[model samples]
Target: MTSPTGEPARTRGPEGPDAPANPLTRLPLDELRRRTSMKWRTYPPDVLPLWVAEMDVPVPPPVARAITDALALGDTGYPAGTVYAEALDAFARERWDWDGVVAERTAIVPDVMLGIVEVLKLVTDPGATVVVNSPVYPPFYAFVEHMDRKVAEAPLDPYGRIDFAALEITFQEAAAGGRRAAYLLCSPHNPTGTVHSRAELAAVAQLADEYGIRVVADEIHAPLVLRGARFVPYLSVPGAESGFSLMSASKAWNLAGLKAALAVAGPGAAADLARMPEEVSHGPSHLGVIAHTAGLREGGAWLDALLAGLDENRTLLADLLADELPQVRHIAPQATYLAWLDCRDLGLGDDPAARFLDRGRVALNSGTAFGTGGAGHVRINLATSPEVIKEAVRRMAASLG
Candidate 1:
């Protein structure tokens, strides 16, 4: 059987350097539907899901081999040792040219978001304010509030970047009540995919120091930066010694289901991380550490190939939008595979995702959940086949008629 795009659905074998330029799109839609990931199972069979952050690609061969070898030897006990942390340190130095990440100062956690929540608890008190950039990942709102904390949003600038002036105002407000606050910064931000420059990060570090607001950066998308953009580790900035950053290979290698992440503390913030309870360390899966480590240490070639494919896909998306949905404005992301489309001109109401799902049978993340400027927008996942992306836009355009 064929998918909505008229492409035949086929399951893929393992991926290697020899795989297609975009190995992600090689999997057939019918085979993809058989998987149990949220990206596949969250919607009805007819709905083309392009919402969640999960990539449709198979794991790199090295990552896959690491996991399989462990399972063969029944090595699925509790995680042990500093291999994961060491691998990350090596990857960071090689990939981003940042040597600030000390393996001794890092700890493994179940995932990046959980690490953020745990780190926030260390920096802020109950009911204290937590600052975030609006039009951000939805979980930033949910997780912070789950801690009984108040969330303050500093909306992004029109160019989809951190609004330094607005951020300073928010930081000042967050610190006004003599309450300790935390800034949840999304580097290479979600939805918009704007990679922050060094100057921008420096400004943030200055503001955080001025207001005494603890900075917890979610750098999960660090490795997925496309061509022409750079991913800088927040800790690499001069005055960011007190910042805490959460890193993971999950997003880069499509290993979210395995669940392992690292929380790195800047030189000044090591004590804060040391205060994190011992029990939290037990959440990371044993196999997850192995898988993620393999991806970091041995999967570099696979990652390079994926980036090239994603680069092509991004360019293709710009062309498709221009030809098929000219009314929709997209910035053609510089980092992540997510494309933030401004659909306000289409006159869709506050919740365009709902209309798209109901009318077009394409599932996209609702922009309303992103807060503030999010209304009349939708976040589309660009990690799938070019054909699927073209088909999704075609369906969306047909829905408008």
Candidate 2:
């Protein structure tokens, strides 16, 4: 393999790792899965919990080095050094295809969704009405309501697809109700894994434009799309300048515990954020910034490999559901590692989460938590080793049987 300069490609494996010998492929499925997941409670060191969105993969080398180097200085107050925001620019230029999207327009937020909350606060007034499409990331409503704002639910259509017409209508009504600044959306939507296409995004932008409302696109999961799937940035889409794009390496690289993210906005939006509190971005977690930038700038190789692992686990999940619990239709995810399963067949009353825990000995995110459209669904994270994921499915199968 030759490099762009015609030299031999760097010996680093696809994801640029050293490509260690006999890499840890898949651990013992059932035991390891239980051991990790059962941590919610003091388990007997058994029972892997595939419930959380965290992946079991190791961090890329550069990220680890960056964190370690930052800590070596023993200065973690507020990142007043040089390397703090270095990764943001490089990452934006490369991975986001931004060419030169000005890191100055990007602000490192404490958490991905916090950026959303801040946007909602800045754009909407107290008691303002905001529109949200259901089966959304449940926290979305909480953010709106916490701000003393009103929430309007426009559930997604059957099969968990967005309804552009419905969104447009809701936008109009919300605008009329005086909460014109509405939440644009959750991408690769939380439970469904449906990757909103360029067309869908356009429709959303168009609706936002129609009502003179701002769009807050929560693009936290943009990097986790299925192989070959296209992710059009909210700002990249036509008329997307009316909105802002929220990005974080936390979800893709399992860095959520670090609590770091950024909001990349357009010229108008950037100017709005500029006048805000001086502490709004206060350092953005120097360690997290390093890891994030490394992931975006150099983690592509690692991401490619990780995505391959996730893709395999995704298939394992689908086939296992079919071969085992026919009623548990595991809808294939187009992006993100979360698997949305139609578990209506089990037919338990409201909140089947407890039922799965007690009987199936498996933990899952009950669909009802998401929205009106999540009545009989469950979201599972399959970002662990294949062995663990398979066993988790087996346990569910046995319980169902």
Candidate 3:
């Protein structure tokens, strides 16, 4: 199949070999605007929305079929068994070559954020401190505060990598007075798209162990690691045996609305994970489990195609910024579809996203909300067609005039 621009499309449905080439190109702008999702409904029809992490791609054929089959059978009820965990285990084993996700040691939760909250409860108290690397997903602050936990920032280095010295200082401060602490690690980090290396994860595990801090990794973006990068499961790290990890196909498969995730426990952390309330398992919907399971179990080919498209979009965006918005610094991401843009040199003040939305009619995520070091930046969702990316850049450049 070919796209509107006559380029070979890179998408495919469950329609065997006849599927299209690009998932991002499957849905056109008019069709997208008709949907009522947050990405589409958040802005007026004239504004091009690219703020949220939601991708502008069609549902994977296997995922759609699974949901359809379940609905046809009237299989809407509470989720049961360990099918989701088992599927994740298989995917991880094949993709990351790690088998730390033992079904017996995993629990199903509503989503990655909820799963994280539950895991944090198991290893931390209401008032305990949770350390985070700044300029991260904003929810890390909102959710942690909502759970009545204090937050300590361990800002990432200037290059967007983990700063060991800053982390150690934050750990010391958080663990002072013999207080229990937890480090919320964002593997294959959001916005920046910096995939943590195995050695880097090992270093993190080492720090957590020395500070007597428990680690809970949010590996939701693991499957979206584009190219030239690797995602290491936290539990697979040696010193992380006492740590926890929350993962889901939600981000990769655009299943956020389906709402199903797993909280995996390392060998040494099994007992603490076991203490989670039984009611927590009741949070996931039966249909969600079915869809996520199908995606993880049978959506491998679809995921690879999506990754290929995203890789292209990242490179396209870098080239666009260089030619049109040269003042905007874009560090091409190593993973995921989100692009972190440094607009500090654009002379648009802290929240350049506002200018882009107001003048350019393009909505991007304001970095200010992403916490410290987020000012003078905006996050652009690159999970769309190349045309949209090009247009967004054009609009951004026009906004400056």
Candidate 4:
């Protein structure tokens, strides 16, 4: 099977009489519990945590070796050069047939959210409005507001695609009073896992251009796009040459702790990117750059295996919800390992995740935190073992009884 891009489909891992192992299955609950990441430590020992975006897999060998080698040589200083951007360019070219990422037009930042804040700073003033499609990643509001920028939401359409009419209205309002505005786009949207089609993104670029709004995109989950959907980098679209993008291997490779990300500027936005403070580049850890560079350059096979596992998990989750909790509406995600479940039918008003955490002992992200159109829903992380997913469903069902 082939994807729309003509690349061989990654719906399943390498298959033979002896297939390559799935990464999600490699770590058991006992082993996972021994680690002390936020996903594991935020709740009690008894609770099943499916809330955070952290994956339940070990570090990919290539990334691990790179970080270890760096430490062995005591190469832990400030990050230097454009190696991270170069590696990402290679990955994008191979995986998405994109050649827009020039190392000279990219900057190293601490991570995706911080990178976004820094890029937003480049395009708009502190008091300007930053328009977003909600319910979006929670930090889109938090970080923008923290920087004294106001957030104006243009909620997604019912099927989780961009609502162009609402967006246009929001854009008009955001640009009112002759205020400089920016649009923060989350491609392959969080929680919903809705991968924006190229047409949709092109339309966005057109609208931003019409509204005199600058665009900044968070493309951190680009590599985690599953079998069916293709990730369209915002900067690759026409009329988007003035846009900015934030890319990272943290989510795809589960290296969030290492803390490295890139801020990529489209050709027309190169001058804006150049205006970014030199101190911002100092924020990324040297080890993080090495780890992310290695992952982007050499971890393709591991990523494919992980995506295959996530594809299975996506289907498994839908089936489990259908059989065990018929009231829950599960839209199988097109990308990422997150599943957004609509539980309004269960009579678990506004925040179903709270009820699930309390009664089911299952920790999930509350939809309310994601802003407008988010109530009565919950986001579940499916990057764990199938056994854990099954247990979580059983507990959730039992809670209703």
Candidate 5:
């Protein structure tokens, strides 16, 4: 396959001596400041904004062309057809070797979070308990509660992987009174880039089966897995046929503004997925389907380039943090561009992000908002140029002095 621009969509090998030129570094600071996205507009000009998960890199050429074509033809109606699902099926087969996903078993929703909320509603009634891994995406707390559901916390281990022992305890507690519950699983977990192993996920499926709990996985960051790490979809595991998974090209290809994501149903949950209200399908934007499909079908080479750039930035961040601020410890993430830092030793108190923003003029996500294990932690986006990562750390170090 070739990109819209006719460039061959070659799958580049892992990052090594022959890595291509860094596309991230090509975007200048002045150009970035002109962006109207939340990352740029959320802070003052002098404050380096690295808090949001948005990437600073330009999108793949094919995605841009697809969007432009939609506008030119005035094809911005409600989304229809199975193009997005078909593209995802192709990408998954080649990328993950998972064939459980078929276009017929998927539905396009506005985005991953909303898709997850809808799936949760299908499994649990209002006021039922919903289990989540804390220090997770903050929206997990808000959206679940918004649905009139109760949330139970299963905090991750010290190493940032899921605490299954603790999770079993929480699941048992939540399952009392015959209350239906669901687990909001974040594979290639956010805040901390812990790409869950296949065994761990199978164990979760086993626990869910034993407890009669439904599992809803948010896999938005699956496509962004860095080198030395692999992402496993929750439904791909054996005994996971009852689970639901949500994925999108938004995070990997920077198409969040386009507003489209897929909610996939395992074989066992086909009836629940088919029962999803028809009105829910109308929420996805037509242009989003076109752009996302193009991304999945023709943007492999571009994605490979992006993973290479992020790989470099991840290493640069570790080196910079060690040289400039050894007190702030970061475990180099295995998947997403996010870096969860242990800032407690910095003597910055419970909320280090607040101090960093006020004193260092660098904005970061406050760990407290992520719940439980989040205190004394901050999530940083490392999806930008190495220069930006270095400068952000430099400014942070100077804040202490």
Candidate 6:
């Protein structure tokens, strides 16, 4: 796993000069000129902002062209977006081989968060217990409370992995006298970046079926799986063919601001989708429908390249960590551009992230923000340039030197 510079850069995977790769990782030379000349009056110039999980790459060429083409027609209002809807259905079908009643099952929402809130309300009762794996996405907690339901925190075990043993006990305990109504399932779980295997999903489906619980799988991270891993859609699992799956191009393709997502329902999934708030979606932005369709349908090449770049960046971050700071344990992320670090040994006493940031001048997504299990960890996003990642690690080494 060592690079020519004696750093841990090359991770094990398919190797070759023509190895599948993304061309966007390389920052243009003109960036040097701009960096040399530019100055931001609002924030400090020295800040390496990797905390927000935004990619620095330009919008994929095809997506940009599609937007431009749409604008040329002066078609920008909420007049029947029939063509766009059709394109999205075809795109979803082709991309994931997910077949369903496209028009009936699918509806455009401004964001995935909105779709989730709607679904949570539909599945749970007032003061109902919604099971969640902590050290999870912040919004999972927010969405539960936002819908007037109580969140039952199921803390994942050490190494920041899911504790299925505890999960079973928790579910059983919740439904001791009656049925456990719902479970917020994060397939290709966020924060921890654990993409559940088919076997795991089957077990989950069995338990949910046993308890008569509704599972809402947030599958936004499915498309971002790295080289050696495969992302399995929860609803598509053999046992979960009757569950709900929430999907978006935002996580992988940087389409969040576009405001679009597809809420795929199972055979009996209509009740959940139908119960969603009516006013929440006037329908997604005109451009969101267009860009999402173009990206999903015509974006195969762009996606492949983007994944390659993410893989390379993942390697670079691991190497830097191995050489620059050995006490911080880490695992080769099965998927996603995120690198999870075990900073438990840092022994910073108070807030480890705060100390690391103060000393290294590197802003990381605080571990505590991900819930209890993330106490001594930080999620490092490698979805940016190698130079930027290296610099952040360099700063970390110096700060803790």
Best by lDDT: 4
> What is the full ranking by lDDT, best candidate first?
4, 3, 5, 1, 6, 2
Model 1, runs deviating above 4 Å? 1-20
TM-score of every prediction relative to native: 0.94, 0.87, 0.95, 0.97, 0.95, 0.87
lDDT of each residue in 1-401, candidate 3, tens digit only:
54222323334223457544779989999988988999999899999999998999999999999999999999999999999999998999988889999998999999999999999988888899999998899999999999999999999988788999999999999999988899999987877888777678899999999989999999899898765666778888779899989999999999989989999999999999889999999998889999999999998888887888898898899889999999888678877889999999989999999999999999999999989989999999999999999999999999999
**Residue lDDT tens for model 4, 1-401:** 75443434445345665544788999989989999999999999999999999999999989999988988999999999999999999999988879989999999999999999999888898899999999889999999999999999999998888999999999999998888899999987997898887778999999999989999999988998898677788899899999999999999999999999999999999999999999999898889999999999998888888988998899899899999999998678888889988899999899989888999999999999999989999999999999999999999999987
**What ranges in model 4 sit over 4 Å off?**
1-13, 16-20
lDDT of 5 by residue, 1-401 (tens): 54222323334444677654566787888999999999999899999999998898887789989989889998888888899999999999888878877877898899999999899888999899999998899999999999999989999999888899999999999899888899999988998998888788999999999999999999999888777766678899989999999999999988889899999999999888998888889988888889899999998878888888888888888888889999988778878889999999999999999888999999999999999999999999988888888889988998998
* RMSD in Å for all candidates: 6.6, 5.4, 5.2, 1.9, 5.0, 5.4
Better of 1 and 6 by TM-score: 1
Per-residue CA lDDT of model 1 for 335-355, tens digit only, reads 888999999998888888888
On TM-score, the leading prediction is 4
Q: How does residue 354 of candidate 6 score in lDDT? A: 73
For candidate 2, give the lDDT.
0.70
Error of 3 at 199 (Å): 1.0
Q: Candidate 3 has what TM-score?
A: 0.95
lDDT of each: 0.88, 0.70, 0.89, 0.91, 0.88, 0.71
Weakest ten-residue segment in model 3 by summed lDDT = 4-13
